[model samples]
Target: MTDTAHALGASRTLWELIDRRATLTPDRPVLIQDDRRLTFGELRDGCERVAAGLYGMGVRPGTVVAWQLPTRIETVLLTGALARIGAVQSPVIPFYRDREVGFAVRESKAEFLAVPGEWRGFDHTAMAGRLGARGVFEAYDTLPADDPSVLPPPPAEGTSVRWIYWTSGTTSDPKGVLHTDRSLIAGGSCLAHALRLTPEDVGSIAFPFAHIGGADYLVMLLLYGFPAVLFEKFALPDALETYRKHGVTTAGGSTAFYSMFLAEQRRRPGEPVVPTLRLLAGGGAAKPPELYHAVVREMGVQLTHGYGMTEVPMITMGSPDDTAENLATTEGRPPEGMEIRIVDGEVRLRGEAVCQGYLDPDQTAAVFDTDGFLITGDLGHLTPSGHLVLTGRLKDVIIRKGENISAKEIEDLLHEHPGVGDVAVIGLPDADRGERVCAVIEQPPAAPPLTLAAVTAYLRGTGLATHKLPEQLERVEALPRNETLRKVLKYKLRERFGAGAGADGG
Candidate 1:
C-alpha cells in the first residue's frame, strides 16, 4: 500500500462510481453498439441482474473470472458486474491462439471462463476447452432475467485484484500485470483528466476491448457519465460512419489505426468531417512525426498521444492544448501526481496508478527497485518542460562500428518510404561490430522486394552513418504481433533472416 493511494481517495470501489453516476444521470445514454442503445439506468439494471446471477452461480468475492467476450454490451455489463461482486476480471483477447489462451487461464487461476459462442470466425468454447478451464458459460446465456436480488459486496480496496494484464513482452517474456482497486480508479481519473473527456463527449473506441486502451476508455466514459460507442472491430469506413451517426466527439486508438484512417481519408475526398469528433487520441508507442502531421492536416482533428503500459495504465498523455511538436515528438507530461525520471537511458515511474508488481517474483524484482520506482525498459530523456520523449527500447539498440543506433529511429525513417507498410529492426550478433542492424519489412504488392543495397542507400541518403545502415534487408508476408497488434518475438524473424537468408522466402 502507498500513501498516494490514500491521498487520492474515493469513498467506494469503481462499481460504486458507476452506480453513483447512474444515479446522477440515470436517463443519460451509456452504451451504444451497432443498433442497440443502453441508458445509465438500463446499464445498471443489466449489471445488477448479471452480478446477482453470477452470485447465484457460486461466484464469490476474490474469484478470478476470465472473459473472452467480444466488443459487446455483454462484456461491458460483465466487467461492471464483476467489479460489483468483488471478483477479479481478466479479459482474454479474442485473437489469442491455443498456447496464449491456455497460459492466461492457468496464469490467472480462473475459476470461471465467460466467452461468446462465435466471434470473428473463432469459436470461444473450443478455445476455452483447450485451456483446461471447466464450465465455460456463453456470453448471452449468462444474463438470466430472474433478477436475483442478492449480490456479493464489493471487495476491499488494496486487497482486491482489479485486473491482470499480460504484456506483449517485446523485450522479455510475458508477465501478468496486477492492478488494485486504487490503481484502476486513479488511472481512469487521470485519463479522463488528460484526455479532456466530458459528460457531453461520446467516447468511441475501435481497438479490441481486451487491450488497456479499450478497457480504460470504457471505464472512464462510464465513470464520468459519458456515452460510449463500442466498435466490434476496426473498419475505417464503418468507423467513420459510426462517428458521424453517433455524434461521437472523442475516439481512442493506436498510431497504426490513425495512419490507416488517414489513408482512407485520402481515398475519399471532400468527405464531411465529423464535426463532433474533436479529439483523436492514441497511446502506447508514439506516432511517426510525418504521420501525425498528415493526420492533423487531412482529418481536421487534433492528435493527442498518451504514454502508459499495462502496469501503470495511462500515466502520460498529450493534451489538446499541447503544441503540435509536443504531440508529435514526446509522450507528453506525466499525468497528475505521476512522477517520471530517466536514469541510465531507462524510464522510471512512481504513482498511485503504478501496479504492485508482476505476478512472478523474479519479474517483479527485475522491474522494480527498493525505492518504489518501476523501471520501464524504454530508453528516453525527459525534457525540461516535463515531457518524456521515447527514443527506443534499450534492448533494441544496435551497435555498428562502435556507434549505438536506435532501431525505432530507423523504423521511423523506413516508414517514410511509400512502398513500406510496416517494418521491424533487430540486432544480429556480429563478431566484428558486436551487433549489426537487420531490418524485416512488409512492402506493398506493387513494390519489388527491397534489396540490401537499396536499404543502405536509403539510409545514406538520409545522412545516416554508413555503418548504421542495415547490412541486410528481408521481406516477409506479415510480421508477428501480439493480440494488441504490437510487434514482438522478433526472434522468429531473426531465425529466418539473421542467417544471411535471401528475401525470396520469409
Candidate 2:
C-alpha cells in the first residue's frame, strides 16, 4: 500500500482525513471548475462554516438531511458540512424525479431536503414541495453560512452508518444501501492504491456527485492531496475545454465515456484528444475489450477499467503496470483485505469496503449468505493470476432450448463489429423457444445499414454457436442509458422488445 493509502486507511472519519490533508497541503488545489478553484484549506474552512449554518437550522448530529444537487463545489461543501455535523445524509441524483425522489424521502425519513431550485428549466423546489418533502430549501448558488465556532466537534466514530446511497432501481424501486465513513475510505483507498496515483496527478469527476462514486473519488483526492476538475454538466466538445484548460491527467467515467473520447479522437485523427491525458480509468458497466484496445491504440492512452457497484464501490481495479492483455480481459485484481469467494459461480464479497447492508433489514438478510459474504448477483471466476473475470449477471443469463448463454458474451463479440457503434443483447419471450436471443444495435452514422441475416452471419464466422447467434436484430439510433455512468438500461430493452414486437429475424 502507498503511504498515502496507509495514512488515509487509519482515518477515523472522512472529516478527519479532509482536515489532515488540508493541514499537509493547505494551499494545494483540491477542487476546480472552470475559473473557480477551492484549495484544501479553503474546503476545510468552508465546510466548517456551512456546518455552523446548518446547525443553526437545527441540523444536529444524526439528523436525516437529504440533498438532490448537481456536481458543484457548493454541493461538496454541503456534503462535507453534513459530515462535520454527523448528519445522516442521503444524496439523490439530480435527474431523479417524482417516483424515485418521493420514495427516497419517505424511506430515509429525511427531516430536511435540499434542491437546486429551477435547474435546467425544471422547478426542483416545486417538485420537492409536491412530494411533501419536509424542510425543503434551495442550495444551488448559495448555502447556509454562519460562524464555525457554533458547530460541535466532528464525529469521531467512523463505523456508524451516516450515508444512505440508493441503487439504480432498474427492475424495481431503488434499494437504500448503507455506508459508513470507514467503508467509504476503504473503497477509496483501494482505488487510489490500485491506480498508483501521485499527488502530482490531476483528476476529473464528470459523473454525478450525488452518486456513490462522488464520495469514492473525493476520498482519493483527500488521501493523495490532489485536485479534480468538476463538471456540473458533462458532454463531449463542450466539456473538453475544461479538461484541457485544467490539464487533466486522468479522466474517465465508464465504457461509454471511453467511446465518447474515442469518437472525438477519431474526428481529429492525428492530434491527441486531451494532450495532458495520460490515463483513462473507470468502472460501472461491462467494458468491451475492443474499446480498451481502441483507446490504447487510437487515443494513445492507458485505459484501466475496474469493477464496482453500490454495494462495494471499489471491488477490483486494473493498475497501470499490468499487462495489456490482463488489463483488457479482466477487471483487475482485488486488493488486500477484500475476500472474493466464488459460490456456485456467483461472486460473493466480504471486506471492509463492502457496505454495512441495506436499510431494509429483510432485504439485507436475504442478500448475505450464512458465511457473511454479500451474495453479489454477478457470475464470474477468478483468473489464475487473481484477476476477476465477470461473465454476466446471474439474472442476465438467456436460457434458450434449455441452454444458458451469457448476454455479455454476445455483446462483447458484437462490439467488435465495425458497423456496430454500441450493442445490447437481451432475451425475448418466444413460444417455440423458451427465450429467443435479440441483439439490439446502434450503428455508426458513417456505417451502412445492417440486416438481421448479416449480423448472424458475422457472428457465425466468428465461431459463435448456431444456437447462441442472435435470432433477432433491432436497429436504433441509440441505446437507452441511465443519467449517471451511462450504463445501458438492458431492462428497458427487454421491456420494449420482449414481446417480439421488433424482431426482424427468422
Candidate 3:
C-alpha cells in the first residue's frame, strides 16, 4: 500500500474511509457506467444526502437493512449511504429467488429492504411483499435525498460488526457471514497492494455488487484512487465495448471470467478482445492450470488467480511481479497481516481480514478452532515459497470402497484435454462402491462428443490411478454456475447425475 493509502487505511469506519478519500481526491473519478461518472466528491456529497434520506425513513444506527440490487452506480450509493448512517447491511445476490432471499432477510432481522423494482422483468418489490419484507423501497434510477443536517454522525469505530454477507448456498440455505469495516478494508488493501495498481489504472466490476468481493473492490478503488467501470448486466462481446471505451487496465471476476474472455478471443482470432485490458485477476473458485496457460497464451494478458471466500474475501492473491510458474500453479502469498496455517493438511486462517464469524453462534463455534483460527474445510499446504496449493474441499473428497480420492486431482487432469472446455468431478452413491466417481463435462460446440472410454483412456494415459478413475460420464450443454464469479455448482451436478442422468461407464 502507498503512503496515502496506508494513511487512509487507518480510518475507523467505512464512512470515514469514504470521507477521507473524498477529501483527498475530491474531483477524481471513482465509478463509471455508460455515461454516468461519479467523482469522489460527488460520491461523498451524494451519499450524505442519501444518508439523510434513509434517516428520514426511520433507519438508525445498527438498523439491519437488506438490499438486493444489481451492479450499478445507485447500488454503491445505497451501500455508502447505509455506511454513512452506520446501518448493518445484508446484501443478497440479485439472482436469488424467494427462498434464499426470505431466509437471509429473516435471519438478519432486516428492518428494511431496498430493491430495483421491476429490474430485468422481475418485480423485486412484489417478491419482497410476498416475503413479508418490511420497509421495502425501490432504488434504481432515483434515490431518496435530503439535507445532511437530519442524519446522525457517522460510525465511530471499525471493530463492531456492520456487514452481513451470504454464502452461495448452492446446496443448502446460505450462511450469513459477519464482517466489520476494518476486516473489509484489510481484504481490499491486500488486493490493492498485491496487484500493484495505480490511480491511472482503470478496473472493471463485472460481477454482482451484492457479493463480498464487491466491497473488497470498492475498497480497492477508494484506497488507490482509481476508477472502475460497472457492469449491471455483464455478458461477453456485448460488454466488451464498455471495457474498451473505458480503457480498463485490469479486468476479471474469477476463473470463469477468464474462460469467457478466452472464448471471445477465439471467436475473433488475431483480434484483441479488449485492447486496453492487460491483467485478468480474481479468486473465488479453483483455477485450472490448463485454463491459466490457455488464457495467458491466447488472450495475451497476465492472469493472477487467488484464494478467497465470503469469510475472508482476500486471503492470498497472485501478484503481477510473481513468476509465471508460481502464478499458474499456486495461489500467491498472503500479506503481512494475514496468516495461513496448514493443520493436518487443511488450510486454516487467523487474521483481521477474516470475517468476525457467522450469524448463528453454534455455526460460529463449529467453524473456528480453539486458537481463534478460522478452520477452512479446504485441503491444502503452503509451498516452500509460501504459496497456497489447494487440493480440494473436505466435502469434495470421494470415498470409494474405503479409499479416499480428491476430486480436484482428477478434475485438474481432465482439464488438460484439448476437447474439454470445462469439467466437474463429483462422487455419487453406488450400490457396489461406497461412492463412485462421475465426471461431468462442458465441451466446445465444434468438438466431437467424448465417450466414457475415451475419457478413461485419456486419464489412464496421464497415469491416473485405477481406483480414482471416473466410473460414469455426463455431458452437458454447459455447466451449472452461480451468478457471481461463475463458480461451477458441483452439488447441482451431483444431484443431477446421481439420479442416473447418464449411463454408467466403467
Q: Per-residue CA lDDT of candidate 3, range 220-277, in tens?
A: 9999899999999988889999999999999988766887888899998878899988
Residue 210 of model 3 has an lDDT of 90
Residue 443, model 2: Cα distance from true site in angstroms: 27
lDDT of 1 at 399: 43
Candidates' RMSD to native: 10.9, 11.1, 11.1
lDDT of 2 by residue, 318-340 (tens): 99999999999999999998999
lDDT of each residue in 1-506, candidate 1, tens digit only:
12322323363577766776678788999889889899988887788888888888877788888877777788888887888788887887666555556777888888998888776676778767766786578984355433646764565564456688766454323467888767877777677767766677798867667766655675576666778888877676757888889998877566656666677777875574576777778676546677678878888888898777778877788888888999888878886689887789888889888888877888889889778899878888888888889876645655442234567767877988887889998876543333567888999888876778777778767644344578767777888877776846787777766666355322
Off by over 4 Å in 1: 1-11, 140-148, 156-159, 170-173, 395-506
- Which model, 1 or 3, shows the larger TM-score? 3
Query: How many angstroms is residue 301 displaced in model 2 relative to the true structure, after the best TM-score fit?
Result: 0.6
Kindly report which residue stretches of model 3 are placed more than 4 angstroms away from their true locations once superposed.
168-171, 396-506
TM-score of each: 0.78, 0.81, 0.81
lDDT of 3 at 321: 92
TM-score of predicted structure 1: 0.78
